[model samples]
Target: MENRNPDRATESCLVLMLKSPGRSKQRLAASIGPLAAIAAEHLCYCAFEDMAAWPGPVCFAPADEHDGGWLAARISPADAVVPQRGRNLGERINHVNRTLRMRGFERQIFIGIDCPELDERYLEQAADALGDHDVVLGPALDGGVVLMGVRHEWPDLGELAWSSTRLMADLEQFCNALGWRMARLAPLADVDTFEDLDALKRVVGEDARPARRALGAWLANDGHRPETQP
Candidate 1:
């Protein structure tokens, strides 16, 4: 069912999911009005496209009611389709990670659907990093985390500050407690706030095609409209 390279799939597994658009990205939606949900949906779609293109096995769990959308039907059922659970970001992520592990994947990476700058090459790097390091983290410019990968099992990160600037630091403390060696990738921006959108525009110069296109459209829409307090 999974048309993945057997050798490659044995080494790494990718976990991805999309939450219902109307229920997610509230801050961005508040900043850009209804377009926020549209942008969030677009970002996740592009992420799925990008990650699905990778050579290894992919675990895709799209929880949205697609309303008879084509992409949902196109997804491979070989990858697990578990909807997100738990009360917060950390719990949901932990739930997903543990589920993937039960499938016997040696390395697991959890990527955010809304992080436009994320692509397949970075995922390759993370999977390769786990061969040596126990943990891998891709930090966000806004002080949140964008990607987290692991090769070794650990406790659920339910206690970490889910959306605060202190989240990565708290994770570092957790790693310290476990005595796990961690690896780092360069920090990237996630378009969670208006300021974050601005920073992403500044940092994502020439390489990220999907991200650039998404930002261009969102920026144009944002510029032509007046801001209201959400």
Candidate 2:
């Protein structure tokens, strides 16, 4: 993709932290059954579209090394496919952050496929926020962060409460202790449950991205059953 903001393009990069589509969104699976995998793929496609449109560099970090090929095939050929290494979320994020920083990307923004509303605009906002603040967080409505951007290497995040509602609070407190300047973006909902999907459908009406529109159609028509059963 062409760099929309050429001035900051070289220094900033977006890291997409992802798990295999077949293995993701287990919580949503409880409500949607096996269709969660299908939904996961759609969410992945949504992220791919956003990343392709991003002005700066974009990298994909797959939880498993075995999924590297799968991700590489989907992302832009120029985008790096870095496999994640860590027993937990915090460690994994720290590893990717450290790795990318060493690769000359001083400003790194991390996001997941769970938030379809995340787009190039949000990526640009996060990149811009990193210019003045030491850290930038895109607050998720469920008391978590949909996006996290940093201008410098992060402190030990291994102890932070990840994937919990206490995540946002814990992160803020951690940053405060280190005296890091923090900036937060507007809150957005991340899809995790059937209720979350329902709320999203009501908002993403016509003119939504193709992947998102297809997801909405599948949910409205076939309902829980995916177009093809796995």
Candidate 3:
């Protein structure tokens, strides 16, 4: 049974899944260098800035238990912190959703900080979609989903394909099997490789919040890669 917070029973919340910078952006790290962690942190900062004025509730799911304090310092004091649990991506997402649903946030949107283009308008669209659809998905150009929101508890997601090109299709079939009405937002890009980072630099250059603009400038200056000791 899901626990319900009476005060927030009718509210919608954004659940951001994050990891400690030291442990994030593994693929980017493999492609770039030690600077992947710094890049990841900057992306998260951009996300934070984007959500700073969101009208709805917001919470964070940290991959590690010890990151609560670290996350706390970056978010508003009213935001909640939930520790992620599960062996795999699918399971972990399920765990976070279930936990939040139990806590009285009936409508919830989940996103990762990897999508630098994600902003307040995109989130508002998802929240609005939930009013008419059971689920809303923001597709990634790489055949994955960058954002997912649900108005009700999801069916068994343990077996769904994750982190693969087949993920979007698998999720659609899963939702179809359960007769859930799913909506899709416009596709976006995620920063997972050196090439993606380069693309993000161009994106933030045109129009971005303060944090993202700073990130764009850093990328322009090749700040992501530091000089190695001889």
Candidate 4:
């Protein structure tokens, strides 16, 4: 895709992707304690900082903006949207992408708030790839993706199947069917379960002070009464 606007380089697109901090997963934190909200806040902060200097505008879509307006202020001018009702994650993402494109952004990238390990270098690479590719993806070690970017008008948001373990593969197949060249960055892991938290601890070590503190506090008081399954 040719740079339709030279000034766009100074204005790369970004979306601070998030869902409401309290919901199904909210109860998990209750079991663990107050650290749940803190953990969620930290992840959002990490994601915001990671893509802070990208080439386009940064927008946020939270499930609710009551607390979001304040949180969004920490990042940039943000727009909140209820995650698409009656839809899966893929549909919601595609909806956000399409909304942004209609607003005149030449390129768009959506990132999840769960991946604190995500960094700017990877985002920069994705921006650079946008110069030639229709889509760029940062695949996660798990069966999902942490980031997705598009340089042109997005296709039908409903065309792609979402939230399955095959999400990444399904997206690739969609691009192939459309004859779009796709690019990928190195895979990274996202924090999801207790095991994921343990891995993050190992990777960051004592230096993982903040996340560790938050995780510890959460585990200490979370009252979910997590069950062990055989």
Q: How high is each candidate's TM-score?
A: 0.81, 0.91, 0.90, 0.74
lDDT per residue (tens digit) for residues 33-94 in model 4:
44455556656555656555455567776644554555555643443332332265666666
Model 4: weakest 10-residue lDDT segment is 221-230
* Cα displacement (Å) at residue 152, model 2: 0.3
Candidate with best lDDT:
2
Per TM-score, the best of the predicted structures is 2
Model 4 backbone overlap count = 13
Worst 10 residues of 1 by lDDT: 1-10
Candidate 4 RMSD computed on C-alpha atoms after optimal superposition onto the true structure: 5.7
- Stretches of candidate 2 off by over 4 Å are 1-10, 225-230
Cα lDDT of candidate 2 equals: 0.82
Backbone clash count for every predicted candidate, in the order shown: 0, 0, 1, 13
lDDT for 70 (candidate 4):
53
Where in model 3 is the C-alpha error above 4 Å?
Answer: 1-10, 225-230
Report, for every candidate in turn, its global Cα lDDT versus the true structure: 0.69, 0.82, 0.81, 0.63
What would you estimate as the lDDT of candidate 4?
0.63
Clashes of 2: 0
- CA deviation > 4 Å runs, candidate 4: 1-11, 24-35, 53-55, 65-86, 159-161, 205-230
